[model samples]
Target: MATFHHYPFCPQSRFIRLVLGEMGIAPATVEEKPWERSQSLLMINPAGHLPIFVEEQGLAVPGAAVIAEYLDETRGLGLDGRRLLPDHPADRVEVRRLMEWFLVKFFEEVSAYLVTEKIYKRFMKAELGGGPPDMAAIRAGRSNVRYHLQYIGFLIGKRNWLAGPDLTYADLAAAAHLSCVDYLGDVPWEEDETAKAWYARVKSRPSFRALLTDRVPGMAPAAHYEDLDF
Candidate 1:
């Protein structure tokens, strides 16, 4: 039994939750306000990041990479119906590459705006800037998302999964980060049919169900959120 310490709206935290649900682990939830630098959260992970997992091993795991790898190697294969990280070495590298693209690159360009404006503000009021969310930044992010989605569409057209032949960590990372954007109806799904189709496949999985249910304060998910076709 693991205890997943999370911030509800953090995409990475939700990514771990989706993995737990897929693994059928039903981890104990410990929602922490990560930006507040709480002694408890920091005690678990001195880095003070959300989704710090208190593992079955009696140690705390920090970051999505660490948690995902731990579960995929030790637990996901046995417990999850869908293997997140494939075994083929070459395929695995592609997965890592795509995961880095979305989790690091996509996040720097997009998630930073929405997550900070919408979710973090509610939890860590102490850390907020005096100015409001920059609509210009938000606009640029939305535009950038179109390009990423197009790239994903290309990948989907060429490969069965985001990373070569298997649905690996890359797929989950993309969906996880995108879910936050989707929650705010920020995704322009109709513009790219191929991207929408690929997203539909990822979001349709049983592991993704819990993430679809998460509701942020004052922000409701779009009507199509629960719709598998969308």
Candidate 2:
């Protein structure tokens, strides 16, 4: 069986996992702490990243975006469900556009800061200069998240899914990041009915059930993190 190395709170890892789930491919999972800089991780991914996908024959695919596309090409096409990527060239562009928006823009502006401060710092060794969560960064992430939430509402309002008619990797990417932030109790869902409704729909998917069960060591998920009705 293929093997997947990842950490629970990492959005990139979560994105890859969701994509794998959509592909109906279950790789043997191995939890990894990249902050620890394990020799095994460095060997698998010279970039020293989390969410490395190693095939049965020992082909290691690193990074979430790369792994997502790799799976779509190798497994997604033959899967017994909706295709993760659109067939048309224009639609593919839109899917990649939104995927980049959530993975890069939203991540840089919000999720990255929050995860680095809130989750990574807590488990990170003191020798690595890890410390208490930075209140300033956390506040900034919280403020930035609202704008992204509005953007999500804007996108979903015009389409059935974030990208287009069918659910694409774009939806998975957005949900992956938002779900991590939501796990931290940082999402203000009550403020945006449209985005919240869209998220509720995503949350109800069978593929998302495993993510809802994720539990960080010392931190419990937000009250509504796993609640389908929320």
Candidate 3:
């Protein structure tokens, strides 16, 4: 069996976890605090990032995008029609585009601020920059999330999923970020019914159940975080 090193609240980590679940790959998971910069973690990934994937052969794959692609190529290809990535060249491009949108753009604009301030900071040491949550950044995350939700609604209006007719990494990526924000009680779900509805569908997936159960040590998820209907 492979090993997965990750943090519960990290969106990128969550994305990989969802991908693994969807692909039916069960790896032993090790919770890691990137801020701690443990020597053991550094030995595997010098960058000391969370969500590293270690194969049974001791090969360490770091970074969320890289791990997602690696798993898709190694495991997903055998899943036939159930693969998260599309088969057509154009469709694959769109899937990658939306994956980037959520993993990078959405994370930078929304999740990074909220999770870092509200969740991660609490667990970090003062010397490592942990302290009271930054209200300004939190406000920015709260405001920015509304726009992203609107974008999701717009996309869902046109296609069954974020990238197209089938569920793909795009949907997983978006859901992973939103799940983090939702946990912080920062998402304005009422402001975008379409997005909320789309999210409900994603939330109900078996692959998503584990994420809903994630609980930060000192923080509780939003009341509706685990409600599939919400």
Per-prediction TM-score, please? 0.91, 0.97, 0.96
Residues 1-230 of candidate 2 have per-residue lDDT tens digits of: 99999998899899888888777788999999868889989999989987899999999999988887888788865255777887789999999999999889999999998989999999888889588988999999999999999999998889999999888999999999999999999999888899999899878987888999999887888888889998
**Inter-residue clash pairs, candidate 1:** none
User: Worst ten-residue run, lDDT, model 3?
Assistant: 74-83
The alpha-carbon lDDT assigned to residue 115 of candidate 3 equals: 90
Which model, 2 or 3, shows the larger lDDT? 3
Scored by Cα lDDT, where does model 1 land? 0.80
lDDT minimum window of 10 residues, candidate 1: 122-131
lDDT of 3 by residue, 16-56 (tens): 99898888888999999877989999999998877899999
Off by over 4 Å in 3: 77-80
Total clashing pairs in model 2: 0
Which candidate has the top score in lDDT? Answer: 3
Tens digit of per-residue lDDT, candidate 1, span 65-162: 78888887778662536577777787677888898898789888887677776666655555455246667878877888888888899999998888
Model 2 steric clash pairs:
none
- What does each candidate score in C-alpha RMSD? 2.0, 1.2, 1.3
